[model samples]
Structure formats: C-alpha cells, structure tokens
Target chain A: MEVKNTKAYEVVIDSIKDMVFKRELKKGDKLPTERELAENLKVSRTSVREAIRALEIIGLVESKQGAGNYIKDDFATSLFEPLSVMFMLQESSPKDIFQLREVLELECCRLAAKNIKDYEMDRLLAIISEMKETDSEERSSILDKEFHNLITTTSRNKLIINVLNVVSKLIEISIKEYRSQIIDLFKNDRKLVEIHESIYLALRSRDEEKIIKAMEKHYTLIKQSVKM
Target chain B: MEVKNTKAYEVVIDSIKDMVFKRELKKGDKLPTERELAENLKVSRTSVREAIRALEIIGLVESKQGAGNYIKDDFATSLFEPLSVMFMLQESSPKDIFQLREVLELECCRLAAKNIKDYEMDRLLAIISEMKETDSEERSSILDKEFHNLITTTSRNKLIINVLNVVSKLIEISIKEYRSQIIDLFKNDRKLVEIHESIYLALRSRDEEKIIKAMEKHYTLIKQSVKM
Candidate 1:
C-alpha cells in the first residue's frame, strides 16, 4: 500500500532525474511530450503529470501555456513550494531549525565582514539607525529580518542568499510565535538595539572573527531567551 | 525592475508567514477565506488566489475541493523544491557540490556509526557486495546511491534524509558528467568495491571517527578523480 503511494511517481521522477544526471536532458531541454513519457515509462500519463507537477513545484521544470515544459537553469524561485511544505510537515523542533539558522547566519556575517562595500556599510548603518527608533515589535521584527537579508545580499552569493531566505522564512514563523515571549524576556528595547548596533559595528570594522562572534552572541542570546 | 518583481504576491506570502510565525495560524487552523483575505489586503480575489496557490505549492497551506485551505503541521516534503533548485543553480562548480556531499555524507556516516543495527548493517554489506559483482556502471551507480540512501534512512531524520536525497541526485548528475569527461573512471571496479567495503566496515564497527574519516577519504579520492 505504501509502495503504491510513493513508488509510482518516484519512478517517473527518478527516470527524468537520471536523464538530467546523464546529460541526456540538459537544462532548457524540453521533455518528450507527455504522451511520449508515458509510453516510454509504461505508466499512465496521470502518473507522469503528477511527477511533472512535482518537478515543476521543485523548480526542476517549468511549463508554459503554449510551450511544453522546459528545464530551468535556475531552480531558486521554484524551491519555495517544496521548502514551505517541508517546514510545515516535519514538526521540526524549533531548536534544531534555530541551530541551523545560527550556523548559516554566522557564516553570512563572516562573509559580509569580508565583502561588504562602503555603500553597503552606509546603508546598513542607516537601517540600524532606523531600527533604533522603531518601538513596535512588528516593525522591529521586519527590520531585524531586513538586516539579515541585507547581510546575505552583501555576501553576493545567490546560493547563500537563497538558503538564508528559505531558512529565515522557516524560522520567521517561530520567531513570530515567540515575539511576545521575547518582548517579555528582554523588556529592554535598548538591549535589542545595542545588539544590532554591535553587529553593525563589527561588520563596518571588517573584523571577520569579531563579526562571527557578535552574530553568534546575538543568536545565542535569542536562543536562550526563546528557549527554542 | 527587480523591486517590481517583488510584488503583492510576496507581500501576501510574507503576511501569511507572519501569521504562521506568530502561531496565529496554528497547525490545522483554517486560513482566512480567500474573499476575506482579498478584502483585508485590498487586492483582487484573483490575486489572493494566486498567493494561495503559491503557498499551497510551498506546503504552507493545503486546500480541499469544498473546504478552504488549512495550515500544515510540518514541512518536510515542501522543502524538496527549493533545496533541489538551490542545489542545481548554486552548484556552478561540480567540485563545490561534491564538497557539500562529502560533508553531508560524513555526517551521515557518523550518525550511522552508532545507530545502525544488525539488519541495517547486513543490508549495507549486501549492497556493497552487489556493487562488487555488478558489471554495469548504471547498476553499480544505482547500488551506490541505494547504499547512501540506506545510511540516510538509518539517520532517522526526514529532513536530513530529504536533503541527502537531493544531494545524491545532484551527485548522480556530477558522476555522469565525470564519466563522460574521463572515460573508464570506474573501470577499476575493485578499488571502488574496496572503498565501499571500508565504509561498511567502519559502520559495522560503530566507530564514529573512523567512519567519518573513511567517508571523507573516499570523497576526496572521488573529487580528485572527477577533477571538476
């Protein structure tokens, strides 16, 4: 019973993946028509379509209205659906996801320390200054997210940014849950402001070790306070 | 142009994410009706529907034919799309992807070292034995992949297993490319067989450090042979 649910579509997907792996199907390679795939695999076109939709959701393939499905060279945009689903289903413990976030964000901070340009630094400072004036937790959270987003952007690697974006979204849900919890725990808005300021200073100083240390400290505090 | 692309859909997505983050939209909570959301956001129902579809694709919400969408409790499956896309797009250099695979596989080996039971160990050994006798490169590769898949399954974490599955698929592509570039790279089937045996022995012995070291060595050799 379990095999029927999982195996049929998997077989079709694996066949296509194998073609991609073998370079028989390169990026932008239009798949054989749906009928052809069904004939080749000895499976119903329904199963083939299911596999194709799954692939499409995952960003491996894209379908146009008139044009048939084509392989995507860039899979980032397509990743949102599957990633969103995985985050929802895993009952993923908050602690584990947060730990993963810390690792990724610390790496981001280190990269930003080394690579952030003067204009970016100026912009970051401006954001930090704006963050200092914001008292609303909702606004603060958005600013906090934007700060991290900016750090990732400055890293200038689409892969890292994409990863950060996904992980951040996953944790952002929990962060929102813990918003009041954080406010109650910290009580001192100044402390939160200081943490962001310190992180900004470390970035501006271009001290890789210091930046990693500060970012780690910031997340460690949040982890402790949230008890995730 | 870039800013324009980041439009209402993203805003709606983020707003829904905020609700999830806040625990306002708990698992199994029925989301706001599309009409209600459209009214609240001052957007067309069509736009709201588009956002909902995007969310559904990402595993954030599930929609039934008669019923409205409901929040998913966990997100393991939804993650496949984005992670796969990132793996394909960011992995510009095959070597970078291979390095990531080595890191992940080593982690898998370490996890398997302590956890693999006798039946699992036997299954792994049988896979290696099959690889030793398999004359077809295609068959050998499938066995090789299954061997790794077995280890991931034994890890007992869906998130880790899913990520490894994506990595393995990417590695399959890399391996095929490598084979094309260097004809007969797998001709010395005996050496490949020995490497798997060594890894299996490490797993059997339940030696975490040794398993990691062996997996790393094996991957390093693979990287050298692939050279790209």
Candidate 2:
C-alpha cells in the first residue's frame, strides 16, 4: 500500500521539504530541536522525533552528537543513498539499470554538445588522452569514469547528474561481479579510446545529431563487450 | 567533503544493505534490535540506533514504535524519497526534469511496444478512451498519469519505472504551481487523447521506430505547452 501521505511524521517531513523549497532552510542549515518543532507544529514531541529520525535515515538531515539535526550539505550523495539500499534489495535488475545509464549518458552527450564549456571540453579531451596512455585496467576505468563524469557536468543539469550518479553506482556494483570476464576485452584500450574520441569530436563540433550517433555507438560497443 | 563512505553510521547502513543483497533479510522482515545489532556488528548501541533511524528515513526500514523495525515492502518509493527531497531543494530545473521524463518515456514506449501484454495494451487503450470522454481538468490529469504509468509498467523495467516515478513526482509539483495557466491548454483533451492514441497504436504495431517517433512528438507537445 502507498503510505507516503497519511502519517503524522510525513506532515513534519513535508514541512521541512516545503521549507527547503521556500529557502527558509538550506544545505547545512540547522533544524529546530524536536521539542521546538513539536511546539511550532502543534504535534507531539514523539511524532516530531519520529519525523527527524525518518529524515535522518533518508540523508536529508543528520543528527550530530552534541548538535541538533542539520540539513545535509552533500545532498546529491544523500539523494541516492536510499536508492543504493533499494538496489541491495534487488528491486531492480542490472540490465534495467544499464539501459537507463545508456539513455542518460546519451542525453548527457547531446546536452554537452550544446552547453559544454571550453574548459570542460578540454578536460574531456585530456581524459581521453590519459586513457590512451594508461595500460592499467584500473587507470583506464578511472579515466572512463572521468570521461563520463565530465559529460554529466557539462550537461549543466544537476538533476541529470544526480540521477546518473545513482545509476552509475548501481552499474558499478553489477560490473564488479563480471570484471574478470571483461578484463580481456578491456585490455584493448585503443578501440575504447577511439570511441571516446568520436564522442569528443562530436561535442567539439557542437552537433547534436553527431553527438547522439557517436554516443549510441559508444554505448553499443560497451554493451557488446560487457556480458551481463 | 563527501562523507557518505567514511562515517560510522554508513557502516551500519552497509551491513543492512549486505543483508538485503544476501537475502538474509527480506522485505517485511524484522531487523535485529538496535542493541543486538550493535553487539553483533561491534559498534555502539547508539550507532546502531542511528543506523536504524537513517534506514527508516529512506523507507528501507519502518519503525513501529512498540514492535521494533521491519523491512518495508514498497522499496521503490524508499529509493526515491531522498530524490523527492532533492527536488524540493530545487537542484534541478523543470526543463531538466522534463527532459529526463522525455528520455525515460521514450525508452518506456520502445520497450512497452516490444513487451506489452495484451491486457496491458487494453488498459492503456481504456485510459486513452477515458481521457477522450473526460473534460474535467482533474479527471484528465489523473488519466494522463495513468496513461504514462501504464507505459512505464509495460516497459517491464523496474529500474526505469523507479527513476520515472521520482521524475513524475517532481513534475507534479511543478505542474501544480502553474495549473491555472495550463488548465486552458489542458482543456483541449482531444489533442491529449490523440497523442496517447498515437502511442497506443504504435505499441500495438510493435514497431520500435514508430513508438519512438510517436513518443517524441507527444513529449515535444508537452514541452511546448508547459512553461516550466
């Protein structure tokens, strides 16, 4: 059953949520103590306490040893924390997550082509070059992450970045289990570098169609190389 | 600094996450008591309590004041709880969220076209017909949700469904703020019905290209109509 809207604790959560939206509170801002919140909202202290606990669990708030609860500063990480737990629950499949990654990364390329700052473009090219020189699978994978991350950053869409961060983490867990099988495939970094270059050239050209084609080819290659 | 990985509280979250993955714990299963968890994991009782609190916030675990904590059954909602909060924080623009919804729905249409069950197709057609008959803004909006929801469900991708659920909630909030302005545009339910029919027919055709084109036009119309 859907249980999001009815609980008293939810009322408190909603209040804080509205506060965040209205900018009465922000990242790292302190929330009033349970007793204070209870008095202000005309709810029992216990309910207020429960609401704070729920928010803390979700990473929207944190309770320090001596301090009261405060809004989390690293909201993006917190935003995906519950999602990470849900992954553990096997609520979603690896293939489903990978498909999402492909969609988001493709969009990221299209957006980056339009809005990528020159510095971000330079960073993307630099990471591609670094991947060419790196022989270690470990280093190559790190560059791979950086390359994709640059694209996400260039998208200038925080929501997309946050969504992708969650999807990428899920992908990482699934990929780790099959790393041994893909190690040989990944050893040929030249093809990988070339794919990224195609992406880079498209972004440099600032052509959305080319970006989409290049990214489609990039993910298709990765999809074929990795056996889920 | 990003402290998601380094905190003591995170250890507790990780342990519970591992349990869920290993199937030592299941949905609706009760977790060990806080004291018991602290002793077994060799952490302080307070740490265990904090962990439980955080998990509860994420909807992974629910606290039943008198009965202790049980794993929640609806984990997908939990997965997006923090993300909902992030939306309130305005980390994303309406355009970004709408862009995301477009990408996901396009994939949803493609997959749904390929995998939609006969019953699901019938349900989708029913919703479109219902939209055609309904002129009330409220009823049309509800049918609009059902139409999109059916597409996501028909996609048979739990991960995509979860991601879109979060995005949909964000869109709902933005739409509510501008409901009056768009109510006139939305009063033209015939156009809405026609767009959905296009999607429904494409899904029936089981042609991925037609589905993509139809879904793209559907969202492009929406993107133009919604100022946000």
Candidate 3:
C-alpha cells in the first residue's frame, strides 16, 4: 500500500523527467500550474503537486509565490539540510557520515595547502589558538566550526564545500547532544589544541604529504573519541 | 521581487525545519494536514503544500494519498535525479562534475581494492577482456559502465554507492551527446584497455599504493582527453 503511494507520486515525477530528456522542459523554465500539469499528465493535481515539491527539494526546482515553480539555475543552496535530517533518521550509526566527512576534509586540506592564502593561514592558526584558550563548550564549538569552515572555503571548490557543509551539519547534530568531536580531541584541552595545531601547521607548510598525515591524524583522534 | 518570492517560500520551509529541531517531529511521524499547517503557520495552503513538497523531494518526507505526509524513514531513493538535472542546466562546462567524479571514483577504487572478492576479480577481469574485443561503440559504453559499477558495488559502502551512482548518471548525461569519458579514455582503444587493466590489477593485488597510482593514471588520461 505504501509502495503504491510511492509509485503514484514517482509516476508523475518520471513524466516530468521524460519532458526533461526530450528537451520539452528546461532549466529556469516555469512549470505548468498544478491543474494544468495534472490534466496534461492525466494524474491528480495532488500528485503533480507532490512531484513538483519533490523536484524542488532535490534542488532542481524553485518555487516563487504568485509566480510558480521554475527549474533552479544553480544548486548553491544548503542541499544537504534535508539530506542531513534524512541521515539522522535512517543511519542510526554515524559511521557513514563520519567517513564521508573525512574523505571530503582530506581533499579540502590537500587543496587548501595548495590554494590557501597567507591571511587565510593566519586566520586558521588564530582559530586554533582560540581553541586552546576557550573553556566554554559553546566557545569550543564555534571555534571548531570556524576552523573547518575556513579551511573548506580555502579549498575553493564550491561543489565540495556544498556537500561538505551538509555533512558537517550532520556531524554537529550527532554530537550536539553528546560532546562535539573537538571537545573530545583530547578529552582535555591541551591535546585538543595540539591536534588542531598540527592541522594548522600542515597547511602552513603547504606540503602535500604532511597535509595528508595531519588530516589523517585529526580524523583518527576524532574517530577514537567518537562512538562510531 | 525575486528575493521576496524566495523568502516567502523559505519561511514555510523553515517553520517545518523548526518543527524537526523542536522534537515535534520524529522519523516516520505524520505531519499535520495542509489546513492545520496553513492556519497555525498563517501561510496559504498553497505555501504549506509547497513546503511539504520540497521536504518530500529532499527525502525527508513521505506522503500518503489518504493518510497524510510523514517524515521519511529512509533516504535510499534517487535523491540525485533532480540534482543531476540541476547541474546539467547550471554547469555549462563539466569541470566541476568531472573533478567530483574523479575524487569519488578514486575512493571507490581504494575501497574496492581492500574489499573485492576473488569472484569479483574474475568478473572484472573478464569485463576488461570484453572491452578489449568489443568493436561496437554501444557495447563498449555499456561494458565500461558495468565495469565501474561492479567496482563501486564491491566497495560495500551504501552512502558512497548512492552518491556515486548519481554522479555517474550526471557524467552519462554530460557525454550522452558528445562522447562518454570512457569513449574518450583513449581516442584510440589500446590505451583505454591498458589504463583500466592497471586499475583492475591494482585492485586484485589489494595494494593501496598501487591502487592510488592506477586510479590517478585513469583520471589523468580522461582529463587530458576531456576539454576540461
């Protein structure tokens, strides 16, 4: 029964995809209104609505009130926000999320080592130092996010940044109730500070081999502290 | 005006997200009906419907025709179908998509090296042998995809497989008209077979360093032939 419900909605969406494949619909093109789409596709208005809604969520369509839904021109939005919630529900374990994060962050650090500017390096180093000085859990959390965001941004790949940002949010949700990965990098302050310092130093050196080592070390410490 | 349209729609969606954050919603939990959401949130029923539609597409919500919508229990659906459409339109060049595919495929090869079974090795070796003999362009293309898919499945990571599958589809769409990356892995055939052979051997041996070198070789060939 539930599967039927899934199919009815998917049928409508597939019809729409067919239109895309045939070049009948295009990016930034306004979709037909609900009634028209339902009538044309011979589906219920409700199904058409659901299909378009699903398309919008997948970052392919954008809804404009009083106007209508149009195909999105770019996918720069927080695509993984809903994706994160989906993970939070399905993946009871954080292993997949953690592994995906590690892969992207390593790539980010490797790229950052090559592309990071002097000022960006200074900012990251300062974030590490601030991590050392901060005693508040809230402060540690903020500094930790700032530290990674700076590095991810420095990597200069919008696609990686987009996906990584969502994965990081998933990580944040997992540990928000427990302790964040940063809070446990040492289970104490000094070790946490040093672990991050190593990352900062690796980026400063701009050595690919050293960057890989430093990134792996960072994940190892976090994985050790993490339940997963 | 465009900005206003974007915000009005976002407001309703943000309300739904807040519900998730506040613990008012749980996995597989049913959502309030459209009227209830419209009234409580003081938005139009149209807006509420659109919000839920967006959520459903993100794999965070499931809708039942008669029962109502529920927070989705899992996210194994093709979340990237629309995402691929989004990219096919926005990205005029395939550089970003190509780079992303390279990164994920490299990871897949690394994991496959460690996890692939003897039977899997035999199957992959056979596929490569077929690739060498196939003179039909269509057959070569299909075999090429099969070879990659087998390695990816052997990696045994659902999340990687999920994301990679979508990324692969995006690549297929990109070259569907011009020529696939595989078709161009070598403008001529022998180089293509040799390149993939290195990858297969590296995997069968399960040597991490060899796998990395082979994977890099594979991408370097494609990139040189690729306009990007």
Q: Specify the highest-lDDT model's number.
A: 2
Task: Tell me the tens digit of each residue's lDDT in model 3 across B1-228.
Answer: 122555455666777777776668777789888888777767788888777777776557788889999887655547556554544454434666666677777888887887889999999999999999988888877777788889888877766676675556666765454345545655566777788899998888889999989989877777677645
For model 3, residues A1-228, the per-residue Cα lDDT tens digits are 123555567777777777676767777788778777777766787778778776775567788998998877656647656655544554435666666777888888887887899989889888887887878878887787788889989987766676665566666775564455555554666766787899899889889898899888877766677645
DockQ: which is higher, 1 or 3? Answer: 3
Per-prediction fnat: 0.04, 0.68, 0.33
Candidate 1 local Cα displacement, residue A66, angstroms: 2.2
Minimal lDDT window, size 10, model 2 chain A: A174-183
| Per-residue lDDT of candidate 2, residues A1-228 (tens digit) | 234557666667767877886779978889978887777777788778778876766667888878889998776554575676676565677678788888888888888887888888888889988888887888877787788888888888888888887676677776564443455676666777888899999999998888889988876775677755
* lDDT leaderboard ranking: 2, 3, 1
Give every collision pair in model 2.
A54-B57, A57-B54
Model 3, B57: alpha-carbon shift in Å? 5.1
For residue A73, model 3's alpha carbon misses the true position, in angstroms, by 6.4
The segments of candidate 2 whose C-alpha lies over 4 angstroms from its true place after superposition are: A1-11, A21-24, A28-30, A43-47, A62-69, A73-79, A176-180, B1-10, B21-30, B63-69, B76-79, B176-187
Off by over 4 Å in 3: A1-77, A174-187, B1-77, B88-93, B174-187
Q: Write the per-residue lDDT of candidate 1 for residues A1-228, one digit (tens) a residue.
A: 123554465567767766764567777778888888888877888778767765664467888777888887655543554464445455567755664566556666766777888998888888789888877777888887788788978766555455555556566777776655767887856777788889999888888877877887787777778775
Per-residue lDDT over B21-67 for candidate 1, one digit per residue giving the tens place of the 0 to 100 score: 55677777898998888777766776677677655654567887789
Question: What's the CA error at residue A109 for candidate 3, in Å?
Answer: 1.2
